[model samples]
Target: MAGPVHPARGVSYPVTALFMVGVFLLGAAFIASYVGGLHAPHPHRVPVAVAGPADATARVDAALRREGDAFDLRTYPTTASARQAIQHRDVYGAYLPQQGRLLITSAFGPTTSGLLRSAFAPVAAADGLRLSVQDVVPADPGDPEGLVPFYLVIGWIVSAYLVAAIVGLYRGMAAITLRDALVRLAAFAVYSAVAGAMGTLIVETGYGYLPDSPWPLTGVGALCVFAVAAATAAAESLLGIIGTALTILVFVVLGNPSAGGPWPLPLLPAFWRTAGPWLPNWAGTEAVRNAVYFDGHALTRPLLVLAAYAAAGIVLFLLLAGRTNPVMRFPAHSTA
Candidate 1:
C-alpha cells in the first residue's frame, strides 16, 4: 500500500524528531526563565549615598543591613558631596541628615526611587527628622517610567533577528558561499542603519521623548541592531535553523527578562542582576538610556560590547560560510 522509502527521507527522521524535542525543551525553558526570573523581584545590593560623619553613617548602615544585604551604603562627609556622587552616577539616591531630605534620581527608574523612599522613611522617623523628597534627575515627563529607551532597544533587537531570518532564508541557511555571506553582512549593515533611523524618528515624533538626542540614539540603535543581526547570521551559517533558535535561547529567553528594563538591576534577583550587564539587551537599553538621560556618561563599555559581538560574528561567518552543517545533511545509506 505504501511506496518504498527513500534513503534520504528515512535517514533524516531522527534529526527532525530531535528538532521537535529541542523546541519542547525551549518552551519549557522559556516558562522557567521568564516566570521564574521575574515573579518576585526585590532589591539586592542597591548602592545609595548617606551624608554624615563616620559614626552616623555606620549607624545608618547597621540599620539597612539589619533588613538585608539590600543597600550598599556609601558615605559622604556632606550633603553636597553626596549629591555630587548621584550626579556622577556613583549612587542612586542620597540621604542628607541635616537637610532632612532624600535626593533620588527617578531617571534611573521609578522603582528604584520608590524603594529608596520606603527604605529611608523609617530611618528618618528614628532620627526624629521629617523626610522631604527631591528628584535630582527625574524621568522625562513624556516618558514617566523611563521605559521608552528599553522598548526602543527591544525594537532594534527584534528587527535584527528578522533581518537574519529573511536573509538566511533567501540565501539558503543549509549552505552559504563566501559571496553570499559578504552580501548578507552588507545587507545587515544597511538594514540596521535604516531601521535605527526610522526607529529614532518614530520615537522622537510620536512620544516627543528623548529630545535633543536623535544622532546618538540612532547610533546606539544601529550598533545594537547590527551586533544582533550579524551574530544571528553567523549562527545560521554554522548550524542552519537550529542556530537561529540558539540565539533566541541566548538573546531572548535569557537576555530579555534579565535585561533590567522593567526595573533597575538592583531590584532584580542575584542571577539576573549578575547576568544583566553582559547581554546585548541590557547594553542597548543602558546605552539608549545614557544617551537620553545622563548626557552619554559611562557609554563606552556598552558600545565596546556591541562592537565585540559584531566583530566576532563577522569573523565566524567568514570562516564558516560555505560549510554545510552536518546536522542539515541527509546522506543516503545502503540496506544490508
Candidate 2:
C-alpha cells in the first residue's frame, strides 16, 4: 500500500506556501522602499544663513532663488550669528559674502555639506571670487562618511528588539508576574549599560571614529538602548507576538530609512524629512553628532525626544504587566 495519506497535509501545504509567499513579499517591499526612498536625494528649502551687506545679500538671495527653492536663505546681521545658527542646527551651512566664505559642519553629514558647497560655488564664481570653505564642525577623520553614529543607533535598536523577542518567548511559555516583568526590565537596563559602553569604546576609542569625549556618548547610547528596549518590551507585553513584528516595522522599516543619518534631513523627501525628527533613530543620531562635533549644541531636542520614548515605554510596561496573555497571568489566590 502507498504511504498513508496525511490527514492535514493538503491544508498544511497550502498554508505553508502562502506563509512563505508573505515572507517574500515583505522582503521585497523592504528593499524597494529603502532603495527607492534614498536612490537620489535632492535638496528642498535647505535652510542657509547668509551674512553680508544689503546689496550682496540681495544678490546672493536672487542667485539662490534661481536654483528653484533649493535654499531657504536667511540674513544674519553678522557672521557670528550665522555661525551660531549653524551650531544651533537652525541651518546646515552659511554664506558670509563679506569674507566670500561658506561655513559648513561636516558633522551634519558630508553629503549635505558637499551639496551646499556645490550650490553656492557658482554664486561666488559669478562675482569673480572663489568661495572659501570653512568647516565649523568637521567630522572625525576615521568616520569620513559620518555614519558611525547612525550605525551605533541601529545596533542599539537591533539589540533592543532581539531582547524583547526573547522576553516575549518566555512570556509565551509561561505566565509572567509583575515581579518577573521588573526583573526583565532590570536585566534590560544592565544590558543597555553594557551595550552602550561597548559601542562607545568601539567607535570612539577603538576606531577613533568619534572625537567627542566618550562619557557623553556612552550615556546617550545607554539612554537610546534603554529607550528602544523598554519600548519594545512594552509593545510585546501589550500585543504579544504581533508586537514584535510591529517593533520591526516601526523601528527598522520606517525609522531607519528616514533617519537622516546617511543623508541629512534637508536632502530627504518631504515625508521622511518630516518624520525623521520624530523617530528614535534620528534623535539618537543627532544627539551623537552634537556630542561629538558641536560641543553638545542643540542637543536638547533630540535628548528630550529619547527621554520621552523611554518614559512612555516604562509607563506602558508597568501598565501592561500582569495584564497580557492568560498563560502569563498570576493565579487568582496566589500572593506570589
Candidate 3:
C-alpha cells in the first residue's frame, strides 16, 4: 500500500520562490524595455509629400517650415505619386492640391504620424487649406492600434525559452546526444507549426487578442517560432540555465522595444534602435510586417539571419553531443 503524499511534500517552497523571483526579474526587464522605450522622448524627422505645381509646392513647404522643424518636405506631381512614396516608406505623410486632402500613414509609428500632423497644421492655417486624413496602408483590423505582431512574436519568444528551461530542469547540465538533438529539433518543428496556425487564427479571427494578416501570415509565424526555438535550444545547450535568462533578456527586453513595432526604429534611442536588427525579435517582426503589408519584399535578409541561427545551432549541438566527456561520481556512504 502507498502512503498519501501531501501536495507540497516533495517541493521546496524557497526554491520555487527564488525561481519565481528570477522570472519576475525577467518580466520586469521586459516591461522596463517596453515602457521605457515608449516613455523616452524622440523628435521625428519624417519625410512628407507635397503635391502640386512648383509654386504651390514651394508655398506649402515654406508654410510647413513655419510649423517648426518637423518635416522633410518633398514635391510630387500628383497625389498618386505621393501615395507611392508613403507605401515605399520614403515619406510619412502626403498632401494633395485638390481640396488639400491630407494622406497620413500608419506605415510609420504614431510619433512620426503626429509630427506630420503638427507640420501640416501651420501649412493649413497659412493657406486656409481644409484637411482630410486617409490611411493608404491601414493597419489590420484584427490588429487594431497595430500591436498584434509585436505581441505575437513576444509570445513565441517566451514559449521557446520556457520549453528550454523546463527541459533543463529535468535533464540538468548534460551534453545532448545526436538522438536527443534530433528529438528536440523535431519538437521545435511541431511547435513552430502549431504556433504559426495559432498566430494566423488570432490575426484573422475577431479574437481581439491579435491583429489581422493578409497572406503568408502563417508561414511568417512558423519561421518566427523556429528562429526563437532554435536560438533558445542552442543557448541552453551552450550555457545551461544562465543562457535561458539571457535569451529572454536579449529577445524580449532589448529586442522587442528596439524593433520597429510600437515605434519606428527612428523614434527609439540610438542605442536600442541600432541593436534591434541584430536580434531575433526584430527579424521576426520585420518578416511579419513584410508578409502582412509589404508584399513580402523586405523579409529576405532577416530570414537569412534566422536560418543561419538555426543551422549553427544544429551543427553545434551535433558536435557537442558526439563527445563523451568524463562524469564525476561520488562514492556511496557505508553503514558500519
How high is the lDDT of residue 66 in model 3? Answer: 62
**Positional deviation of 246 in candidate 3, in angstroms?**
0.9
lDDT of 2 at 194: 93
Quality of model 3 by C-alpha lDDT: 0.69
Best by TM-score: 1
lDDT of 3 at 319: 63
lDDT, candidate 1, 1-336, per-residue tens = 555656655555677788889999999988988887788878887889999877777778888987788889999988889988877677899998665689998886678888999988888888888889999888888887888888889889988987797777666663367887788788889999998999999999777888889999999999999999989988887888888898889788888888778888888777888888888998999888878877888798788888998999899988987887764555554444
**Per-model TM-score versus the true fold:** 0.90, 0.89, 0.77
Q: 8-42 in candidate 3: lDDT tens per residue?
A: 44446786686689899998887878787767657
Model 1 clashes, total count? 0
Error of 3 at 206 (Å): 5.2
Q: Candidate 2: global Cα-lDDT?
A: 0.81
> What lDDT tens digits, residue by residue, belong to model 2 across residues 163-197?
77886775542225778767877888999999889
Per-model clash counts, in order, read: 0, 1, 2
Q: Model 1, residue 77: what's the lDDT?
A: 87
Candidate closer to the true structure by lDDT (higher is better), 2 or 3: 2
